[model samples]
Target: MKFVHRLCVLCLVALLLPGGPARAQSQLVLAISEGTSGGLDHGRVIAKYQDLANVIGGVLRTKVSVVFAREFATLESGMKDGKFDFVMARPSDYPARGMRDNGYHYLASAQPDGQCLIVVPKDAPIQKLEQARGKRFVMPEQVSYMSRFCRAELRDRGIDLAKENVQYVREQAAVTFYLDNKFADIGAIASYSGPARKLDKDGFRVLHRSVAQPYFPLVAHARFKPEQIKAIQMALVSLPDKAGGPEILQRIGIAAFDTSGEDRMNVLLDWLEK
Candidate 1:
């Protein structure tokens, strides 16, 4: 699996090189980052996104190759150096940075915005954000984007995690374990995360639902002209209306692409950085 993954990644990178048949052909590189710690492997990522890449290629009249970035550092460096012609990623902050500091323009975001859910045992006394103060909090690793997101949400509610009793885990599922085993009083996880889906079944309840923000944003590099960006944006927004579009969306795990998140995307880093 490792060899196959590396070979595929190399093939995609080769498309960008000069002096080959691929060089003579017009091509655009689309960098995709699910998140540094996301569960999907390279093969799964390609299967999920190749169709959308084909659609984008058709619209742009160029070959669109997909590159899966499994690490945040690689994604950030690629954006900073203008290595990716387009990017669509989750944990939104990475793409948000691409737009704010890397000259990328927000094109669209996936529907059903992401929220941080503060979870606790169903019988726990924490009924509100204020009550969560001083309680042992379990969340994803401090370096993970979701951790930053949850911290930001808690901070906004006057609950500073830095001052609170907290347990940083490597996975969201571990957050649930800490809560279940009585190792923590409260926990945080993304609403779309795996553990979040089983909250009710596992006898946990959402103590607080943080504010929704744009999720899985798609942005175009500054190299694209305004008209090109507009075209790409429209194509993505109208994807669901086209034939096979629904299947494409199902494969990609989003209902539709929203083009109205430009404002939210613009201020996302500010909110997270605060």
Candidate 2:
């Protein structure tokens, strides 16, 4: 009986030993912020984020981690709110209003240049940007920066925007529908979306591609530790020119986060003010 009690006590001690669930803990709360807007799945996105974090901290020796949170409020909020330390945010939507309130600042930008494309149904006869007038054009929505940038490009080219022929539909896939059902003459999408062949089996072709813009931006909380910020900057600057580069880029869905400093963003803020 005494031997049995001793064995039970040893098992209990093993359950409570170091490296157990109660003892093992994480120090850093590294996180990626993303919006739950529209139909995007949060769980899938978070899983991708965890895989990337393993590559960096596990492979790169940064001891960092990555997490994905789908709250619109968390995504919009700034770093000083202290809820998040890092963010892989799209340039179109960051420093969302009224959360951290100090606004977000850039740490690095995806090195890949962005390209915009104009699309039309495989059967449509429209051949020119000007042909889009009085014909409905499908774009994501007003709140998206890509949509605004596309509209601004047309406006700068002297196209009138307030005409009865001009209109916007809310979803990008809607562009596919408009083309498939013959509901519209044109649509716009990321040039990288590549010929709509993958997005839809029905054919769609590119009509226009925009001059490239700054690739996606990586942002961090204003309060991120200085050492952590510097380490990230160093890692990006020294990203090897071999498999490491392509590997990291593939995980982040960009070619590289460029060495270009934050000053490059001044033009963006200027455009916003203008």
> How accurate locally is residue 190 in candidate 2, as Cα lDDT from 0 to 100?
61
Which prediction has the highest lDDT against the true structure? 1
Cα-based lDDT for every prediction: 0.88, 0.59
Clashes of 2: 2
lDDT of 1 by residue, 63-101 (tens): 898899888888999999888888999889989999989
Which stretches of model 2 miss by more than 4 angstroms? 1-26, 34-47, 51-62, 78-80, 95-104, 192-202, 224-231, 237-245, 261-264, 269-274
Shift of residue 11 alpha carbon in model 1, Å: 23
Which residue segments of model 1 deviate by more than 4 Å?
A: 1-25, 37-41
Q: Judge candidate 1 at residue 238 and give its lDDT.
A: 86
> For residue 191, what is the lDDT in candidate 2?
52
Q: Report the Cα lDDT for candidate 2.
A: 0.59
Error of 2 at 15 (Å): 24
Model 2 over residues 1-274: C-alpha lDDT tens digits? 9999999998788668875544434334455644323444656665556555554464335445565655656655435466555566554345332112554555676666555677887668888877777777777676666676676666655555555354466656676777678676777776544344364356876777776655555666665566766677666655546445566567656666674746545455444334
Best by TM-score: 1
lDDT (C-alpha) at residue 52 in model 1: 91
